[model samples]
Target chain A: MQLSTRNQLKGTIKEIKKGPVSTEVIIDVSAPAEVVASITTGSADSMGLKVGEDVTALVKASSVMIMK
Target chain B: MQLSTRNQLKGTIKEIKKGPVSTEVIIDVSAPAEVVASITTGSADSMGLKVGEDVTALVKASSVMIMK
Candidate 1:
């Protein structure tokens, strides 16, 4: 499926921190650089995410903020 | 102030599309890489944002998504 979100970074699953309702996935997009994404536990379970898996990190433009 | 958001990309304001309630801010973070942000018009007006101004695009970990 196609996404309208502009920022899509290629990464691999570095770590997964599972919570009761949410899960935090730490991705290694670039060396020494990690991006963290918090998704619902349901989504995580549905995706069957595992460590060392290749994935894409997506952030909607509306969810982004500009710091001046 | 310090932010907990993990992704902070530096860029210049490339374009601004203003609407009644929300405004879209396009940032050129790197060559050929642009990140878009939608912020409230009130915040936009308060910030006095304009094109060519340097800014940072921030996305909270919760706002990010993982796609496999």
Candidate 2:
């Protein structure tokens, strides 16, 4: 499927921290750097996410904030 | 305010495309690379954002998606 969000960073799943309703997935986007994404646990299960899997972190432009 | 979100990139505003309800903000984070952010025009005005202003783009962890 195609997404309209322009910010797409390719990475590998480095860790999955599970909670009751929320899950935090850490992605190794660059060496020594990581992107932490918090998604619904149900969504995580539905995606069948696992560590060492290749994935992309998608961020919508609308959801971003400009801090001055 | 202290934000739990971990992703924050500093950049300078390159352009602001205004729309009736929404506005698109382009930031030059790195040389020749830009990050596009869309926000409500009301919020944009309240923040008093302008072109060439130094700002930081804030992305919440929950708003991020893990795509495989």
Candidate 3:
């Protein structure tokens, strides 16, 4: 799908933490670099995200913050 | 600074959009893959973020969600 956001990292799922309302997904983007994303529990389940699976973490530029 | 977040992408500043209170920073993570992050104007100014500067996009897994 064409995403409006510019950053799209190729990653592999490394961990999944399911919460009552939200789910935490850890993705191994590159060695020693991982991406963690919190999404709704229902969305996680529906997506069937599991460890070792390839997925894309979509972040709108609006949701990203810059730090020095 | 060491962050608790897991996703950190090494990139170069590509664009900057400043608003009244917030700023939009876009980074080129890889070829054709860019990441957009929204940060406060104060923070952006304090950090002295500018184009062509090297940066790391830190994303908390909790702030990340999964997609198919």
DockQ of each: 0.13, 0.13, 0.12
Once model 1 is optimally superposed onto the true structure by TM-score, how far is the C-alpha of residue B20 displaced, in angstroms?
41
Write one digit per residue (lDDT tens) for candidate 2, span A1-68.
Answer: 54444334433344434445433344433322234556665666566555545555556655665554
Each candidate's lDDT (Cα)? Answer: 0.50, 0.48, 0.45
Candidate 2 Cα RMSD after full superposition onto the native fold (Å): 19.1
Worst 10 residues of 2 chain A by lDDT: A24-33
Superior by TM-score: candidate 2 or candidate 3: 3
The residue-by-residue lDDT of candidate 1 on B1-68, one tens digit each, is 53444434433344434445433344433422334555666666666665555554556656766555
In candidate 3, how many Å is residue A56 off? 1.0
Write down the TM-score of every candidate. 0.46, 0.43, 0.46
Candidate 2 segments whose C-alpha is farther than 4 A from its true place: A1-33, B1-34
lDDT of 2 by residue, B1-68 (tens): 44434434433344434445433343433322233466665666566555545555556655665544
Steric clashes per prediction: 0, 0, 10
Worst 10 residues of 3 chain A by lDDT: A25-34
DockQ of 2: 0.13
Q: Single out the weakest 10-residue window by summed lDDT for candidate 3 chain B.
A: B23-32
Quote the B-chain TM-score, candidate 2.
Answer: 0.44
TM-score on 0 to 1 scale for chain A of candidate 3: 0.50
lDDT of model 1, residue A35: 46
Q: Can you rank all candidates by DockQ, best first?
A: 1, 2, 3
